[model samples]
Target: MSPVFAHGQLRLYLLSLLNEGPRHGYEIMRDLEQRFNGLYTPSAGTVYPRLAKLEEEGLVSRGDDGRKVTYTITDAGRAEVARRQADLGDLEDDLDRSASQLADEVRSRVKGEAADLRAELKAAAQEARRVAQPATGEPMSGRARGEFEQAINELRQSARSILRSRKTAESVRAEALRIVHEAKRQLDQLK
Candidate 1:
């Protein structure tokens, strides 16, 4: 659970989601994950209990669609959503801040790891040079260049593998476009 949502914020947000359409527990979780750009996903333990509470409170009704149970917001839930529309806005702002913070943290961590890797490679290169020096005191340019090339190739392969495993290039481009559109919207709001 992210602290981004205050005490009862998740409950209200769930109602808002149901207000849009009826969804099972898993669908709601997936919706939240997608909304946050895969940054936050609530587990069944978290969502199911909350749904049960909402049903108990008469704010939402549950219907069994085959074996899956779907939740629909009742009139009471819609009234609550209407009453706290401003709070929903605040929830959106909180999610934006949380996503930005998480992105910053990931960026800084990757930068630090890359810097450390560079330092280690430099030290290893120096040690290799000391060990490979001939008695004639000649520079081992050929060997050093080969080793550097191999290291670069290995790094390239690792990067390519990661990119291939994580997502398709098209999906990455789509996500970038989504972010750009969101930024444009925020800028337009300012004007």
Candidate 2:
């Protein structure tokens, strides 16, 4: 997952959130998720530990009601927030950019998958046509059928390898090799 905050930025952001008003831990988490446009949601393990640390540092105080513990910024926490106002602004900008980038990546991936589906549909249509009307009105010879199945198997293997590598340079190289091999096979078939 993309990081929503830099190393020390979450602590500062939490302080700023509390500076706005007292909030329960779940409220803080939901507020953060909203702020990031649902791109990020902090787990309880992540937020509660940091809150505990802030309490230890005397920057925040927690009040336990029967069911929920609400946290409020201490005077020191407000002062810290005020002092780092500029830093907080920068953090907000970074978070906005990160969310936009993540959204863009998701969109691009969906487009790619759609394109792949279209190509597969086209290939299946072509294969159906070939099967329905053979060149000599006869089924493919055993050797020709074997070659066709081998080619399909190779294509599946290449696709699996590429997906496993996730578009890395090594996967790109493997794709190139697969293309070269297929080209050579086609040339041999022509002869």
Candidate 3:
């Protein structure tokens, strides 16, 4: 949860969003996630209750359209939005700040995780090379070393590409961790 949506601000913001157009609950949740850059995704539990509350307060009205219920801002909702124009502006500013901060935090965490993964991979490669050495204590053959290095480089590049892709940071992080873990597992098998 974000402080931007604290203290009944989410209700007001939801009203602001409905002011733009009518939407179902899922669309409202998706819109909020997009607006926050995927940093905050409100579950149905969080959103539906607030919507129900707003409906109870006569700030919004819902129309059943078969399987979906579309919510629209009532005249009272528009009035509330009009009355709290300044607060809405402040909330927007807070949202921008919070999104930026969350993005930075996610980047920092991913960077740290990537660094740790690199260190572990490097150590595992060195250990594998050591363990696979001949009785003469000779290093791995040049061809074998080249192939190993290339594989490691490719893995690193794949992780970097995932991080830089258009996917959300959370998804990127998960994919990167998956790659790292799989690589580690494969490396451990060589032991």
Candidate 4:
């Protein structure tokens, strides 16, 4: 299945995470972090709401043993988890063939790519922090702050493309790639 990374997706993740056994929210996050190799350790805000949603859907039932709210997958949730597991297997096999090797090939590719991404994000955050300093640019006044918020909103909108289905994701990826290419061209022009 196309694993959604949104807050709503936490239902699927929580169900899937608890397929082996019951777990609380933090336990679910820890399991996901382990499974995803620390690429995503979902925050409480993302996890809890999704768990609540799952409960409402009857996919995840909560049992307060004593302290923490323990969640176990229902029969419907188990079937959903089974379907998703098969989907995940298909996705994995496709990824394996796409890279023309085992999953390790992709993992090997990530080392450099992740490092570069970390550095770039770090630089961007540093730049943003520097630019947002109270001493500079009048602290982003009314219209400017609105514009910044608008930009952020658009980014979140685009990021939501990942939540789309496989067919839709293909189209979204094309658009995203086009945008990335344009950004690269602009950066080259700046250089």
Query: Tens digit of lDDT per residue, candidate 4, span 18-96?
Result: 7778998889878766655544456898788888888898887899978899988889889888888766565545533
Q: For all candidates, what are the clash counts? A: 0, 0, 0, 1
lDDT of residue 69 for candidate 1: 92
User: Model 4 — TM-score against the truth?
Assistant: 0.43
- Compared with the true structure, what per-residue lDDT tens digits does model 1 show for residues 113-181? 445444544444444444454668777688776775675465445444434554323444344344334
> Best TM-score goes to which candidate?
3
Scored by Cα lDDT, where does model 1 land? 0.71
Candidate 4: lDDT of 80? 89
TM-scores for every predicted model = 0.62, 0.60, 0.71, 0.43
- Give candidate 3 regions above 4 Å deviation: 1-4, 133-191
All models: lDDT?
A: 0.71, 0.74, 0.79, 0.59
- Per-residue lDDT of model 3, residues 1-191, tens digit only: 23546587788889999999999999999999999877778899999999999999999999998999999999999999999999999988878888888787777766776676566556555645554546676778887777667756766776677676664366456756775776677666765
Candidate 2 per-residue C-alpha lDDT over 23-109 given as tens digits, one digit per residue, 9 for 90 to 100: 999999999889867656789999999999999999999999999999999999999998999999999898888888766765675
Evaluate residue 168 in candidate 4 and report its C-alpha lDDT on the 0 to 100 scale: 36
In candidate 1, stretches whose alpha carbon ends up further than 4 angstroms from where it belongs are 120-191
Better of 1 and 2 by lDDT: 2
Error of 3 at 81 (Å): 0.7
